[model samples]
Target chain A: DTAVSQTPKYLVTQMGNDKSIKCEQNLGHDTMYWYKQDSKKFLKIMFSYNNKELIINETVPNRFSPKSPDKAHLNLHINSLELGDSAVYFCASSQEERKAFFGQGTRLTVV
Target chain B: GESVGLHLPTLSVQEGDNSIINCAYSNSASDYFIWYKQESGKGPQFIIDIRSNMDKRQGQRVTVLLNKTVKHLSLQIAATQPGDSAVYFCAEVTGGGNKLTFGTGTQLKVEL
Candidate 1:
């Protein structure tokens, strides 16, 4: 079974449309994170939530918002998606001070 | 503003050879370090990690070394195989939260 899972492995939409990516972890970890991998393959942390508490928010565009209903679920919603937003999104979770496990990743394509 | 960066952007090696990927961090406060393997169109999978207190840690066929003095980190994979061809990245975490600063990454190509 997948430890961390993401939905819609590939998303293609218009530049001004809205979309969301969902992620879940079955490992029962308290911490969940979202990372964006650019076309250049540089992965950067966007948001991380510890026990449903908002923490580690990068300077991502306000158009992109992350919501964590529970410690096991962290989702990303984008408004007015832009061309620059075309990239891969990954979900990860870890125990306190422990190694993180990642999901299969979702590739978002904004045209 | 400090970030983890890699020395080489890409490397190629014979399938049976060894692979060493280097990373340099700018944050001395970083207390945790990890190495990840990312295949094409896939997420980054954790390979190994080492805390600032230790200099080396090994798992399976991979080894992670942390040189806190130089703010440098490295990952070594023994007997690189064709399945080892992927992008490797080093990550650093300074606090207890889940935030992680990742290196630019080094693409490893294993030639058979």
Candidate 2:
């Protein structure tokens, strides 16, 4: 079974369009996070949720929002995806602040 | 934002030799650290982690060492193989449930 899974491994869209990426984990972790890997392969934290509560929301654009319906799922939605938004988005989880289990990542490409 | 950095952006080692990757972080308050290995076209896989209190931790074929005073971290892999060729990243986590800052990553090329 896929431990942490993300849907649509590749997404191609136009600028000014809205898109969303879905992630789920079966590890029964209490915390989940979203990270962005830029072209230079720099991974940065975007948002995080703990027990379905918003925890860390970095200087991410307000156009991007994260929704966690429960402890096992977290989704990222972008209002207007620009070319600069083209990057690999990863979903990860950790229990009690241990090692973070990450998904394969969703590669979003804005055309 | 806090920054994690790697001393070498690229490293090449022959197979059967050992590999060592180094990282430095600017945040003194950071206590938790992780090393991730990412193969081309794949997500990063957890290699190992070291807490600030611990100086060393070992896994099957890897060892992570941390120096809290200098905010330095290193990962050593024994018997490096061609399959071990990948980009290794070092991440730092503060005392929180989230927020992991990753370095630019070191491209490890294991020569056959």
Candidate 3:
């Protein structure tokens, strides 16, 4: 079974289009996170939810919003995506301070 | 302003040879550190981890060494194989928040 899964493995959209990436984890973890990996392969934390509560919000712009319906799910919604939005979005989940398990990641490309 | 960074962006090694990837962090408060391996088109997979309390931890064929005084960490792989070719990343968690900060990845190419 896939412990952490993200939908839309690949996404290509226009410059002004909006998109949403879904992430779900079956690990029963309390902490769920959204990360952005740039072309340089630098992983940066965008948002984190602990038990459906917003915990970590990085310097990301307001165009990106993360919603957590529950502890098992965290979805990212991007409004008016731009060229700079092109990157790989990854979903991860962890229990307490233990190691985190990451999903396959969704590649987002804005033309 | 704390960040984790890698020294070398890429490393090439021969099959059956040992490989070492180095990382440095500016946060001295970080107590937990982990090493992750990411293949092409895949997410980062956990390989090994070490805490500030310990200087070294060994896994199947991977070893993680942490130096708290210098805030440096290293991952050593024994008998690297072609399947081991991937990007290796080092992450740190601080203040018990469990938020992992990943360093720049190091691409490891194992040549036969």
Candidate 4:
């Protein structure tokens, strides 16, 4: 079974549109994370949630918000998506300080 | 600001040849490090990991070397196959291991 799963393998939307990506982890991990991979293949952490508590928030724009309903689920909501938001979004989960398992990413393209 | 970076953006190797990818980090507080492999249209997959306490750790055909003194990390693959072609990333874990900082990826191309 896929340990970490996220919906919508690919998304394409026009500028100023809003969309959401859902992520769920079955690894029973306590920490979940959202990462953005740019066209240059640079992976940056956008947000991290530990036990449904916000732990790490990078310098991402307020247009991007992450909500964790529980330790097993973390979803990303993008408001008024801009062209710069075009990239791959990944969901990951880990147990404390251990290695993290990642899901197949959702490629977001804003035209 | 703490950041992790890679030296080479791309590396090409022949099948059956070993490959090495290098990374450097500016965070000394990071005690745990992991190496990940990402194929096209996929998320990064964990390959090997090493803690600050150890200099080297070996997996099936992968090896990760950590140099805490210089804050450098390296991942070496033995007998690299065509299937091993992918982007490799090195990540440092800090903030009590809750936060993971990833370096720019290195694309490995294994040619037959």
Q: lDDT score, residue A110, model 2?
A: 97
Please identify which of the two predictions, 1 or 3, would achieve the higher DockQ against the true structure. Answer: 3
Q: What share of the true interface contacts does candidate 1 keep?
A: 0.62
**In candidate 1, residue B93 scores what lDDT?**
74
Off by over 4 Å in 3: none
**Tens digit per residue, CA lDDT, model 3, A1-111:** 999999999999999998999999999999999999999999999998999999899999999999999899999999999999999999999995548899999999999
What TM-score does each of the candidates earn?
0.95, 0.95, 0.97, 0.96
Worst 10 residues of 3 chain A by lDDT: A93-102
The lDDT values for all models are 0.88, 0.90, 0.93, 0.92
In candidate 2, stretches whose alpha carbon ends up further than 4 angstroms from where it belongs are none
The predictions' CA RMSDs to the true structure, in order, are 1.3, 1.3, 1.0, 1.1
| lDDT per residue as tens, model 4, A2-90 | 99999999999999999999999999999999999999999899999999999899999999999999899999999999999999999
lDDT of 4 by residue, B78-108 (tens): 9999999999999998888888888999999
Tens digits of lDDT, candidate 1, B51-95? 889999999999998888898899999999999999999988777
**Number of the top-ranking candidate, with TM-score as the measure:** 3
Winning model by lDDT: 3
Chain B TM-score against the true chain B, each candidate: 0.96, 0.95, 0.96, 0.97
Tens digits of per-residue lDDT, candidate 2, B76-98, equal 99999999999999988785635
Best by DockQ: 4
